[model samples]
Target: MAHIPIEAVPYLESAIYLPMLLIVLEKDYELIEHGQFKLKRPYVHLIEEAKKLAQRDLQDVKAYLKSHYLKVVQGERDELFTEYHFHYKQILEVRRYSNIRLRNRVEELLNLYLNKASQAHSAIQ
Candidate 1:
């Protein structure tokens, strides 16, 4: 398996959404490359769903660092990523959730990451 350092990961809040966001972006890229690109409706819906959460102050310098890392990786300022980048920065500034919840969500997101990976592999096979 490939390795990624903890410090390489963007804002802590991103651990919750970054994987999902990357999956969406990957799908978008695939569709475009296949010349089947539509409006990317599912990606749009995911963004909307993420935005439905109540506003909180999560912005911080650390979050900015992470988001900037992601922007550099993507090499473009797409709307979905840019918005999440902004949100993560906000979250870093002001925490809205408890530690216990944070740990649980991290676990949940790990499962999501694994599930998505498996499904993608199956699709390719």
Candidate 2:
């Protein structure tokens, strides 16, 4: 796997992405619990689903960040990002009713990183 730069992740909060992330993570956990991880087709399909969801959620987050940062923070010159330290908080609390799947996290991160890198590269171009 290619390395992702630390700063590229943005100092964003987890709650922004946590709920959607949990969905993907839960699905992955189910697959593991059922012992279906050996099937390449199922594995691939789960990864695809996770990637699609992550992409959609990330887009929402990007839009929210743009609007919120501009309207509330930049326009008003608020220091919330500094005082509250938004990055450290759990953006969304995982309801433990469902188990978390490790594979889902890997796939989600992979897709998120790749998409971000592509966006950054295109922006530079």
Candidate 3:
């Protein structure tokens, strides 16, 4: 097993899961829009802002990966664990993450990004 660079771990993980987060946010936005909520504007705005932030962060992550000549490739996956190949220069490190862990990490990231967006919105007011 090749050693994975510590600095690249977060970027690699984000590159894998941020797209999943965006899809989840999009669906949640649609659901909130159509759901029976008297005050939907706040919810909608938060999701919109969070989505924008996530997208921007994802682009930055991609740029970082490109500049560092790093790549993550999805490998075999099962219900419990998903496999990924992290390539940096001549090193190819294989990692397996549990599905539950991935879900939890994304949820945590969503809350974090949402809070950041909320703070930004509050600051503007």
Candidate 4:
């Protein structure tokens, strides 16, 4: 008896398929036919898990984008600074490190928001 390698299990599962056609003569088995190949059976579960993880990451990113927009409008300078400090690399990359005009425009908008929030806060006190 030969011991089967565990690593070969995935390969075997991937190759496993329903025979489309079988030609048998007299009682002895003849040809076994199959169809187009696809990913291993075990990998289907893993693929689904990976898709869920990707969707979760995308949702987190979207939430962050929306929160950033709202925070700017609310004049949360401290929070904005913290967020930008953590994501400076991403910011630079997204803006392509070009277009000084755009950068300045972003700064102006943030400042405007912050001032408005501060004024509103002071009025409440």
Candidate 5:
């Protein structure tokens, strides 16, 4: 698993919600004809949960984006400090890692939802 920076967690979390939900629903269609759509699927509940999570994360995302812009004050003297801030690098790392995590979760959910024995029943007669 890759590491996502704390600052970018909410943005990544919110970003995953829709993609995950879409993958779930699309799998139902793609797998249904192949007799692998679950009869008692938790799609509704899963969507609700995703919605809640997205809502929470969206608030954080908005807050972060809104307040993240700030001007750093530099001292007249730069002889004492040589290190510089790496906030942009950290954010990039977080986005990269979060994307990996999202892709992994999508694959996992697809396998679990479409490969279940209980899901081997066809919706179409």
Candidate 6:
């Protein structure tokens, strides 16, 4: 194991989980589109905006990882936790996250990133 930079951890974790978030968002969008709702536009709009923001952030995360020469690889998995291998330069660090924890963290990060994006947009307007 190697010492991983604290600053890089979030981006590395995002790299592992953002795609999962995006897929869930996509499915939710479809479900909302077909499900019963009094006003679907608002829900649809929110999901669309969230999706766009998430996609943009994911791209930024990828670029940051690339520039920093950091790579994250999915490792072994069992019924409980999943392993993620982080590669920086010639060093390798492995982190294990439980399935429940991974889901919770991704949800937290989604809200965090979305709020950050919304705040930045508001400041610009």
Q: Which candidate's lDDT is highest?
A: 3
For each candidate, the alpha-carbon lDDT, in order, equals 0.43, 0.45, 0.93, 0.30, 0.44, 0.86
For 14-73, candidate 2 gives per-residue lDDT tens digits of 333444465665666566657745666645445555555566666666665554441111
lDDT of 1: 0.43
Candidate 4 per-residue lDDT, tens place, 1-125, comes to: 33333443322221111010000110111111122336343333333333343344445544554444311111123412311111221232111212343345434533443354455555666
Tens digits of lDDT, candidate 5, 27-121? 65455445655663454444434444435544665566446541112223233332212233233331223445556676664454444422333
Per-residue lDDT tens digits for candidate 3, residues 39-81, read: 9999999999999999999999999999998999999999899
lDDT of 6 by residue, 1-125 (tens): 56878999989988988888888778988999999998998667667777888898899999999999999999999999999999999989989999999889778866875576566566767
Q: Where is model 2 more than 4 Å wrong at Cα?
A: 1-38, 70-84, 87-125
Candidate 5 accuracy as TM-score: 0.31
Candidate 2: Cα lDDT at 32 = 64
Q: Tell me the tens digit of each residue's lDDT in model 1 across 1-125.
A: 33333454445456444554445545544665566547665544443333222112123433565555432122223323322222222232222444455446655654555455455555666
Return model 6's CA RMSD, one decimal: 2.8
The superposed Cα distance between candidate 2 and the true structure at residue 2, in angstroms, equals: 42
Q: What ranking of all candidate models by TM-score puts the best one first?
A: 3, 6, 2, 5, 1, 4
TM-score on alpha carbons, each prediction: 0.30, 0.32, 0.92, 0.27, 0.31, 0.82
RMSD of each: 14.7, 15.2, 1.5, 30.4, 13.2, 2.8
lDDT of 2: 0.45
**Superposed model 4: Cα runs more than 4 Å off:** 1-35, 70-94, 97-125
Model 2 lowest lDDT segment of ten: 70-79
Q: Please list the residue runs of candidate 5 whose C-alpha ends up more than 4 Å from where it truly belongs after superposition.
A: 1-42, 70-102, 105-125
Q: Rate residue 4 of model 4 by lDDT.
A: 33
By lDDT, the better pick of 4 and 5 is: 5
